[model samples]
Target: MVSVPTHLVSADTEWSPLRSVIVGHAADSCFPTAPPHMIKATMPEEHFASFRPKNRFPASLLDRADAEVRQFVQILRDHGVLVYRPKAIDWFAEGGYTAAMPRDGLITVGNTVIEACFAWECRHREIELGFSEILADLEKDPVVRVVRAPKVERPDALYEGIRGFGQKDAVNGEVNGTHTVHSHEWAINNARPAFDAADFLRFGKTIVGQLSNVTNQKGVDYLRSAVPEGYSVELLDVTDEHAMHIDATILPLRQRLLIYNPERVSKRALQKLDLFKDWELHAYPYQPAPRENPPRYMTSGWLLMNVFSLDEKKVVVEAGDVEFAEYIRKLGMEPIPCPFQHVNSIGGSFHCTTVDLVRQGT
Candidate 1:
C-alpha cells in the first residue's frame, strides 16, 4: 500500500476534503491507572474514583469499544480514505494505558508531526504506537519536520485551583472525597510545556486553543511559538470547570458551519472573539442517556460533538445519535452514521479516535 507522503500530511483546515488519517486502536485499552488530577478534573464528581491509579478498565468494555472501532475503520475505507492503525502494544505489561486515541498524542501541522507533551505519566509512550506510520511518511517526503516536546522536571511545588474552591480544598475533595485541603502538589502538573492534540481547533491560518486541566499556559505558549509565520493561535476561554478537550466543545464541520456544546462555552468569551461570530453556530442539543449505562466515567454525553468531517458535505456521526444526524442533514450535510456508543467508553468519538493527516484544501 502506498502511504501518504510526509509533505502531504499538512491539514490546513477541518472542513477540507480528507484523504489520510490515523485511526485509534480500541483493543487492550485500559483506563489510566495513575491518571493525573487534570484527567480527574474533567470527570463528574461521582465518577472521580474510577480513574484512580491501579484501577484498570474492564476487559468487556474494551472488547465492545474495539468492535465499534473496527466498524468506524470500515466506514472510512468505504469513503475512499487511507487509514493507519496504531502499533498495538502490551498495555498491561508496559504499565499505564493503551494507545486508543491517537488524537491526544500526535498533532500534524503543515507536514510536521509534533509529539505532544502529555500531562499524564501513562501517556508518555503513546507516540511510539504510530512510529512505523510516521517513519514511512518521513521516508517518502523530506518536508516533514518532527517536533518533539521538550522534557521538564517536576516543580518543587505544583499548584492547581478549582472553581469556587482553593487548590487545597479542591485537591482534598477529589482525593479524600471530603472537600478539605484547598492546595497542594497537583497529582499531575506540567512543569514545562505539554499539550494534548485535542486541545487545538485548527482552521487553516487561525487556530483556537482552550485552557483546561490538560492544557497549561506553557503548552499554549509553545504552540503559538511553533506555528509557521502568518498563522495565529487564539485562546477559547470556556469557563466550564470540566473542560478537558476542545473537540467536545467547538467543532467546525465545514466552511461557515460549526457545532458546539452550549453548556461548555462561556457566551461572553464567545462574543468577544470575532473569529467565531461569522460562522453559523449550532448548539448540539444532547440530553444524556443516549444509551443505558453508557460510559459516563471517562466522558460526558457531549461526546456527540466529537463527530469527524469526511469532507465539506459529509461527516461521520455516531450511529446512536439519530437526532444529531437529522440536525446535520438540516444543516445541508450528509451524516454517515456509524455505531460508536460502545467506543465512547474509551473516552472519545470519531474525532477523538482519529487524527487527520491530510486534508484537500488550505
Candidate 2:
C-alpha cells in the first residue's frame, strides 16, 4: 500500500534531535477539505447547544485520534522534549488556526513574525510569532531576517491544479502548490518552503474521509478539546483556488530543511530554491501522473509526514529517493531517510507523519 526505502532498515532514529512537531487528525479529512462521512457519526444532542468538542467526541475514533496525538505529545515532553505547539490553522472555518505557546522554530523578519496572520484566527486571543524572540533571548544569535514578499497571491488560473495535463497544468496553473498563493506573496528571509505542507505535499495532499462540513470553526473546536485550556485558536482566511491548504512558504523549522515545488512560488521564493541555511534540505520531486506509478516525489504531506521532529543531523524523512534526497541536500543538512517508497501518491512524509510542539531542546 506504501513504498519504503530499502536502506531505511539500518537508518538510525536515535541520533535525531526531534524537538517541536505539528500534529493533525489521523484518518480525518485534510484541512479545508471536509470528510463528509464524519457527519454520519451523529452530533451530540447538546453539540448544537454548546458546540463543544468533548460532547461531540464523547467517545469515538475521532476522540481516540485526538487522545493518541495528545498522548504522543505528552510522551515526548516527558522525555525532556521541549515541544512547541503549532497552531492548527482551521482553514475550513473562521478561527483559522489554534495558537500554541510560542517557543523555538518560529521565524520573523523586520520585527514582524512570519506567523503573524496565524494569530488572526482568534477573536479575543492573539498568537504572535515568538520563536525569533525566544531564540534570541537564549543564544542572542541571529539568522537571516529579510522580508522577501509581502504576501502570497493566489496563483493565476494558468498555474492552478489542472486535471490530466500533468505538471504543465500545475506549473502554468500555479505550478506546484502556488495555486493557493493569496492576493500577496512574501517570505521573510525567503526561507525554503520545504518545512511547510506545500513543499511536503507537492504531489498532492492525501485527503481521507469526505468533506463532512467540518469547517475551520469545527477544527478550532477540535483543538480546544485537546490542548490545555491556556491555548486559543487562529485560522487563516482562505478562499477558492488555494482553499484551506497550509501554505508551505511560511513554516518555521528550527532547522532550515525545506520541501516544496520550486515552480509554485515567486521568483523571490525561487531565488532561495538552492539556498539551504546550514540545513541539509531534502528535495522530493513529484510525478504529475498516476500514469507514472513511480512518481518522483512520493513523500507528499497531509499524511504520515506532517510532523517536525527536533533531532540532530539525523532527521527522519518518510520519503523515497529522488527529490527526498535532493531536499535534504538542499538544506545543507544530511538526510536520515525513512522507508516510504511511494509516499507522494498517498500524500505525506516523515514531517507529515508526526506533528510538532516546539521548544528549545528535546
Candidate 3:
C-alpha cells in the first residue's frame, strides 16, 4: 500500500510513485539571453542568434507547446496525480527566459524544495516571477521547508576573468575564500554559487549530479548544505564538453535499474559511485535521430532520455520516439506516448517541464 505524505513537498528518488507535481506553461517564453561566451558554451551553435535580449520564441511554437503542456497535465490528473501550474509571465517584458522548464529552477529533496542560484542574469528572477505563489502555498504545510537561493549582488563577477571559446585550460580562482582551479575552463568563474537544479538527480539517500557549464564547484557545495539531513550529493564525471543539465546523461527508471547515454557518461564512471554498486546499469543502445522541422534550438537529439516517470511501472515519453518507447517496454515499463515535440523545441521535454512534489515514499 502507498503511504500518504503529510508534507506538501517530499521526493528523494526519480522513479518513486509520483503523487503531486508542478507542470510548467510555455506561453510568452522568450529565448534566454546571456553573454556571448556563456551562450556559445552551453547552447547549440545553430541557435546562437536566438539568444538575443527580448527575443520571443515563434508564436506558432509557443501556442503548440502550451497545448501539449495542458494535455500533459490532464493525463497526470487522469492518473490521480495532483498538478500545479505556475503563474504566466511575459518573458519579453521581463527580459527573461521561459517558465516552461521549472525543473531547471527548483528541486525537491526529502521534505524540502530548494531553488537554484542561476548563473545567467536573465534567469535570476525566473522562480520569483513565475512560481512564488506556489512556493508560498507549499510553505503553509508545517512540515515542509523551502530554501530560496541567496540574492547575487554582483552577477557580472561570474564572467570577469574567463576568456576564449570552449577549451580545456586551468585557471586559478578564489571562491568564498578557498583557492580553486578546474582542469577544464568553463564559461563562468566560481565567483558565487551558480547551478540549475536540473544538474542533479535524486536516488534514495544519494543524489548524483555533474559539474557543467551552468553548475560550478561552489554550486555543488551549496547544494550539499541545502539538502535535508542524512541525504548526500555526489558528482559524476561526464564527458560532454558542452554539458549543461545531467537529466539527459542518466535516467533512473526505478530504484535499481537505470539507462545512461554512453556518449556523455560511461558505465565505468557510474560504477565508481557506491550507490550503484548493486544496481543494473544499461547503456542506451540506440542513437536518437535529430529533429529538423520544428528545430531543437537548445539541446541535442538525446533529449529523448529526458523522460518523466509517473511511477516505477509507467513513464511519459515523446510520441515520436517509438524506438525508445519500444526499448523501455522490454525493460518492464509502460511508456505513455504524448505529443511533446513542440515543447522539446522550446527548451526541454517532460522531465524538464515538471517538478515532482510528492511521491509514495521518500
Candidate 3 Cα lDDT to native: 0.89
Winning candidate number (TM-score): 3
TM-score of candidate 3 relative to the true fold: 0.94
Q: Per-prediction TM-score, please?
A: 0.87, 0.34, 0.94
Please, what's the RMSD in Å of model 3? 5.0
lDDT by residue (232-287, candidate 1, tens digit) is: 88888785666578998887888778877788785556657778777777777667
Off by over 4 Å in 3: 1-5, 165-183
lDDT of 2 by residue, 194-235 (tens): 112121111011111111111223223432233223332333
User: What C-alpha lDDT do the candidate models reach, one value each?
Assistant: 0.71, 0.29, 0.89
lDDT tens digits, residue span 1-362, model 3: 23345678888999888889999999999999776767767778788777778988999999999999998988898888888999989989998999999999999998899999999899999999999999999999988899999999998888777764333322212121211224487777899999999999999899899998899999999999999999999999998878899999999999899999999999999999999999999999999987797999898899999999999999999999999999999999999999999999988999999999998877
Model number with the top lDDT: 3
